[model samples]
Target: MSPVPPSNGPPPIDAATSPATPTISHPKPNGEGEPADASLPDNYVTYQLSRQTPLPPITWGNWYKELNLLHFAVLGLTPLLGIIGAFTVSLRWETAVWSVIYYFMTAVGITAGYHRLWAHRSYNASKPLQYFLSILGAGAVQGSIRWWARGHRAHHRYTDTDLDPYSAHRGLLWSHIGWMVFKPRRNPGVADISDLSKNEIVRWQHRHYLQLVVLMGYIFPTVVAGLGWGDWKGGYVYAGLLRLFFVHQSTFCVNSLAHYLGDAPFDDKHTPRDHLITALCTVGEGYHNFHHQFPMDYRNAIKWYQYDPTKWTIWVTSKLGLSSHLKVFPDNEVRKGQLTMQLKNLREVQEKLSWPSDNSHLPVISWESYLQQAQSRPLICIAGFIHDVEDFLDQHPGGRHLLTKYIGRDATTAFFGGVYEHSNAAHNLLSMKRVGVLHGGAPHGLEDKAIPPSQRLRIARYNEMSGSGYSSGALSDGDGFMA
Candidate 1:
């Protein structure tokens, strides 16, 4: 069925909304109609759900009225029996191994088939490969390819909104499984599935989806173990019901945990995040932030070291002529997204830090005044700046004597190389001690006489030029000077 438009549909039956799921108005970057501020929380950005109205909260008294009977039965009955089967059945090694192998096979059906091939069209698969994935995807029991892909596409188009089929903003439980178990009175926003309709294999799978579920999801696993090694009970319990349970929950994590946890490295404007645990659970779908940002890119984890078995499978299939036309977002563009987030984080840190006063604000003192002020305090003149080094004298790595000897004198040459060439660290530390600037800059006569070529001062750019000088306000008192 084509999705009913959200606006045209009746009010949502809302069966899971709770106090935790507040009616948060769509967040604004800088409190409505202002330019975005990078320092704001992740949600306060351009990419957000544009909803006319919040979905109404659930009426708990009538919660049972909204329960989807078929969905409630399958979801409730299977998991309970699967749990009981776990305790009753003794799992055979053969069935256990098949379950592990089949788990990966079915997972690829969702990731490579339902997700990449049909939903996002990130790649193309050969007819044989398509058939293989469709059958196995049915075994995963997550609805027909057309059904699953339509909802998934809608999820991308309307993420974190009421129209999203499994919107993460509704709370983890609702996103994970409650959306399926309960019926929404309002339809989710529509996604175009014209491409899905054109695919003969998808139509075939949807037509026979129920029969396929019984055959591929249940009977095949039981028969594989029974006929191969006489472990039908183990196969039905462990490989069939139990494996299905895990597959469903793992897929659900992409909707819940992927949105709830981890850092958004690509774009924090949406709910998706990149987390290792989510990747490990979802067979490489854990790089959700990247996936949401570049939906057409076949690979979720773009880095070589990141774990993405789904991407590897697609790549290997291309070599075997089973799949082709794999799409990749431009490397430079991807890097730009990463760099943007890094800069935003740096801006946040920069906001919290203290910086020295600007050079233009410093007081200009005469050369005569500099010599006069030196007698009262441990004042040293270097690189044109008057520094009160009284507090830093004992902390100086060169010892108190070296600093004491330079007091009331121009030590620019000695600081550069005549005594000891200091590190950039020393320059930075000295900058903080600045009290004032010498009139007409440094005393060139005192600094130039007998100073070796290596000891000559050099001007650098930006902060290095002035050594980030600022005053302590105590420099205004001059009564104790020797002038």
Candidate 2:
């Protein structure tokens, strides 16, 4: 749906009438300028449903598309050309070093430059840094910064889903290089990257990409090594073809290996993981798990000991005035994510471990606080206890999407009688998974209390008795076990 033209006041209330509280006004059904309800209380706000524009469906007439002939020619032939040149040519160590240098610079151009600086906006680079990085990135044989950034942003936004240009879930080869050769259907490019297009440098590079690649990517490296060092063939062999192959493979591994290998300290809901091998290979992009969790932060490797050269480069450049506004998340938040995930994973082994349920050590939160956790870390309050149900969301008896709706709010009604009328064993499960005690605010007309010790035993017995026979009326808040 298109946007409704906004007015100065919603549910219009004159400042003279109510100084502190603003009233929300909706369109009158009778086509009048006033609000639909004339009996609204003074100083109160009225909220109506907001309209959201539905996205157009993705159209793919065919299920599969043939691999791009040009991509196959370029990628496939590069290795062949490099192997032939390596055998045919006498490549000097100095010439090979030049290729290594070029490889490092170009990799940075993609990792630190295109990935972090442009794709994630993790830091602010000076105009000169951005300009140079943009040029070096073009020399990497990768697409222009504009194109790269758009696809990358989409990869992060949709990530692991079908819309991802290089969704790792598609398979290692597909995420690494197969995506370039073939796709599902018509490409929609990226969803939102107008900011990338605004830069004149990015615009110019995108427009003259063919020229830039031929010069900086191929010819220039060849000529510089040949003329500067008296061996053009060796330059072409080592610094051109071989270097391009290495850079491409290394960068591609960030998409493939980073998703498949290593550990997910941040979240496992998505495929991205933190692999030290990938980080070292991709110049600090190996911390895929952290990157996915905190994409806004410039550092993929949160710790100093971690091998994140790109993050270090950005930091050093920022100190040197080549970059600024280096974004890093708070240490506490990072710790919280780690602890949350750790506890979540521990639940799998919770049956083996004994849980001490004093409820004194756990966090006490308000209803609003519980709601805020639902934004990412979904939690549910039930029977005077708050449980982190993020891991259980998908495997819910009902449905993941259905359970998501009641997240952050109390599910006591649905569990007891409203909807599913969970069995005795199910109610016992809630007691087993308690993370914290629920504090009833003054508004709820209830006092804060920990779950009674005897109630735990009672539920166990209830579950045992229900094994023989069970009835809906027999369940009274799990036999008055509800605190």
Candidate 3:
């Protein structure tokens, strides 16, 4: 719950303390290129970061000396108390209901406030709502907004790699909560959330995180029980420890269960999937595949009735004038994604069986054509089909970085791995991008615009080979060949 290690963070700015009047932009937060509005109030919050990239995922090697004693103790004791309370403790009906209420509120603080709003900057919230969410988030004991969001942002930036704080690739327990106990021995030395480091309110919240967590998480719930129902013990057991335990597990499930099970309707190459069970547990975060693919979109559930209370909560807040500028993925893109997913599913079926596919005389296109399109047209070769993915470079779920290496080259291994495999959706999507089949070299006339063939035999041989009238060994440069 305390401030942890670093990601590359932003420089400080303030409306009151800063020398220049600062602009605010939280909610549509941490995004790049959102034009600063001159019409807004001073001390406005924005989520854009001055420094966006974090250290590579590989930098934070497993250097922890040993288990963190404090984390070890808490992990051990909290569950022990919960078991004892389950057997020995008596709870009034009032206690159970109120405890559920408290649990819901605190969970929202983490998912809605800390995760979506602050960490992802998927929407906009007013200062009052920000304050409300921050306080409740503190009660959830998930660290201050800056601290929580810093780690979360890194998780997005590096994803399933080692740099991710809750990397599900490490295993279920480790991704869930064991990382807290094992601890990181090293730091990134910079935070990827410079936008937060400079926010005055965020800074204030971080400064008082420990005290606020104790007050908001424990004392407040206990006081409500004592005053309302005259059962402080039940309040502490149900609303305090029991509620906290559930919230913690629910949050961790977004990291653990989400990656381990369910169908990946989005990019299946990466860990994580969309799971109804995980969503019900996390109050809407079970749409892990969608969440990972569209982090900036405010809605995890892209459907009308996908059980995303968090999305509904944000929508309601906007209706109540508490939140605004909620971002949603464009409809066309959604449809395109669905189509791509369906295609990938078909690909999986094809891979599992040999269906006499027409490998017969595909259109022979020049490798030179792919070379020319490598940047502008951006093509990738997979299973002998050349796909024009210039439009797909930026839209790739792993970001543009992952696709760059495969430009004008075969990406078969990149798409499949020993322990992992891309979805049938991916294969189908790749197939749709197909422009032509592999040809070793430039075609006739494509190599040279000038010289006409001297003889009919020469022209016939040229056309018979790669065409362009070049010699058979002319493409010895090797870059002309597909990998």
Candidate 4:
């Protein structure tokens, strides 16, 4: 594999850049602000900018892309090969059933477990659930959980930009599968997965990625064939090769097709969208738009009617005490924001229409006019307050509606300034943060602090030892830890 060099232009100062360090301002004596002469140190800005190192160029040998092409060929030719193999050798029904079952099980492990749980932290699961999902995810042969989550997180952080590892904006062929094949860039020092890297399971999976893939993808099938079918060739053909082909394409579709098609009910800043067809193939992960909009949401299909078997699985497991901390976007906030955007679009259309004054005019309202009217309405203001108070009532139980009277009006400025001022809202506004349901507005006072480096090293060592079979700890099944 070869590394691709960074583009030879001024780097874009987008989300892809490292977090900015703020310049501190010291307070002056006499309770006044510091003087303007207290300037930033020389080269401070340049130093900060220099911290944002460009990703290394991706380079690959001719055989790398060629090998990928071969894999693609293999995938396409698998069905034909299956036919040929069937004629040459008896293809058992058990082999076919096993192949299909394992394909779906491991595929869901990647989409539902790795992508949603590990990468996005959509929800917290029990240790056994985590182990089960992580192991299955590791079997997908798509790199380790840490690597996948790192790349995926970066993709979301800098979507559509050159920094995006597999941006669909590049092209279908490139985004869908080419990036994985060529590996033209080694983003050394760019894999910002400090959080997940600290995880022992993730680190273990990353190191023994190939081993896990081979074991789950091939060994398991061989074992099944030996015991059930008594025909190793049948297992190799169906459960091994054909199953691999099916899982690969189905998972890849999320990258290529999921972004290209489907309805975007959430944010539209990027191509991630919801598609029922894609979800069916990807184990209820078709709601890409919602996923992107609320990456922390464990349930992709927030609505009960949406087809999400993976979500159902998680839900049932949670009820059975197999999962916990199931995250979800607040329905009111999601709906309200969507409605606001839609109303804005409608107002824009109304404004653009130049209807004749005398031609049976229906009362068409402009956005600005509507906003002004709504803001002036006392009833609207009262209603908004009432709604907020009611929602918070459950949490505070004994708390009364101190300002329960501002629902439909433009009391946002006052309400926000008064209540949410000292909260994350203030920081977000000051920092000019992008609005998205998935952003997790503030720290929420429930964030887990960074784990100590010493503990991390110990975990890594434990994982290494465990994977090497030196540790006697039995593999955690989905029982104690899952609950």
TM-scores for every predicted model: 0.77, 0.62, 0.61, 0.58
CA deviation > 4 Å runs, candidate 1: 1-55, 438-483
lDDT of each: 0.80, 0.73, 0.71, 0.61
**Which digits, one per residue and each the tens of the lDDT, describe model 1 over residues 54-86?**
445568886788788988887787779888998
Clash number for each model: 1, 5, 31, 28
Instruction: State the lDDT of candidate 3 residue by residue for 1-483, as single tens digits.
Output: 435445656654445676674585554534443323323343222212223343223224643445667776665676678668767779899989998998889999989999999899899899899888999898887678988888887777657765577788778987898777765523422235656666666887899988998898788998999999798877777888888888888888888998988998878778989988889999899998888888999999988978899999999999999999999887777778776787678756645742211223234556666667666656776554566777888898888877777787767556656223766556546545655556542234333311112221121223446443322223222233222
List model 2 lDDT by residue over 281-383, tens digit each: 8888899999998999999998889998888788889889999999888888899999878866665555465543444345556556566665767767765
Write down the lDDT that model 1 would get.
Answer: 0.80
Model 4 ranges with Cα > 4 A deviation: 1-90, 185-191, 344-353, 357-483
Q: What's the lDDT for candidate 3?
A: 0.71
- Order the candidates by lDDT, highest first: 1, 2, 3, 4
Score candidate 4 by lDDT. 0.61
| Candidate 3, superposed: residue stretches over 4 Å from native | 1-65, 185-191, 352-483
Model 2 Cα shift for residue 225 (angstroms): 1.7
The order by descending TM-score is: 1, 2, 3, 4
